[model samples]
Target: MKPSKLLITLLALGVFASLAFGQRRNQIEFYGGAAFPLAPETFKDYTKVGLSGNAQYVLFPSPRLGITFNVGYEAFSTDDEKFTDALSTEFTGQTASYWVGQGFGLSPSATVKSNLLRIGAGVRPYLTDPEANTQFFLLGQVNFNLIKNDFSAKEIPYQYDAVNDQLFFLTFNDEEY
Candidate 1:
């Protein structure tokens, strides 16, 4: 099926389920948690940690069941200093030798950031009686995500010529998707 058609169908199903169940109570909840990347090995040189938050509105058709609509955002960032430290540790001797031979010094800086937005519909089933002050529930959701990534870096190399008594400077800037 086409993407647009599939979206419409899913929306219709959500509406049907809500109507069929009948609304008894309405609630809004806000929640947040730490996020961990699934593939840590893939990003071996970098530390990966993220934070996510969501707001959900639930319609309880019956005490035992509820239909939920949710929207959420998540952000992750990797520090360039940590990356530089890793590289320096791995190639310290080689880098020193190269710099001594070339009569120059090198400095590098970089940062990477990523973001995600999610929209979803789901069902929450209450395990305990709804009248209870505290309830345990299980949630099942289907979500659509919009994602973006950004990377930026700067490198500078400098050298001094004793005979010429002149200083040379070079700069590079890089930005990527």
Candidate 2:
């Protein structure tokens, strides 16, 4: 058979199979777990621990195959920014600047933090809850990754000479990014 014809035949077969296995109802689930940062530089090593939570709603409009929609959230922060700040501060020529523009002085820098959100779809063979009002169902699911409350970049560094020997700045202890 021609390639296009064969592709159409396969798609029709899939739809037929789904109708043959159709269940009557739908199911939804709510759950939360821990999130691990998979990216190396995006999140701090092991420091990006966070919470994962989502709601999955399944639509078993037919039988064998159902569609799932998942909406989820994951919160995280990385260690690279913290490490970078520390390394920069340790450099010999780098001085801490007291004010925003003051630099090459005893300027304190902070790390960057981030929150992520996730969203996706999935399929399951069987899903049911006899006790629920609905009956005969398949499970559909989705996963979502969302990034909320993104942190701002640290202040840019500038140069200062001995003409401005005095450096006085006030920073709040609770400030974090």
Each model's lDDT comes to 0.67, 0.56
True-vs-predicted CA distance for residue 88, candidate 1, Å: 10
Best by the lDDT measure: 1
Give all TM-scores, in the order shown. 0.62, 0.50
Point out where model 1 deviates above 4 Å. 1-23, 40-47, 82-103, 156-177
Error of 1 at 3 (Å): 35
User: What tens-digit string does per-residue lDDT give for candidate 2 at 1-177?
Assistant: 999999999999989867754545577889999987676543444256778787887776555456777888776655644544443444424433324344334445544556776788877554555345554645455454555443332432333345866433333323353
Q: Top model by TM-score, which number? A: 1
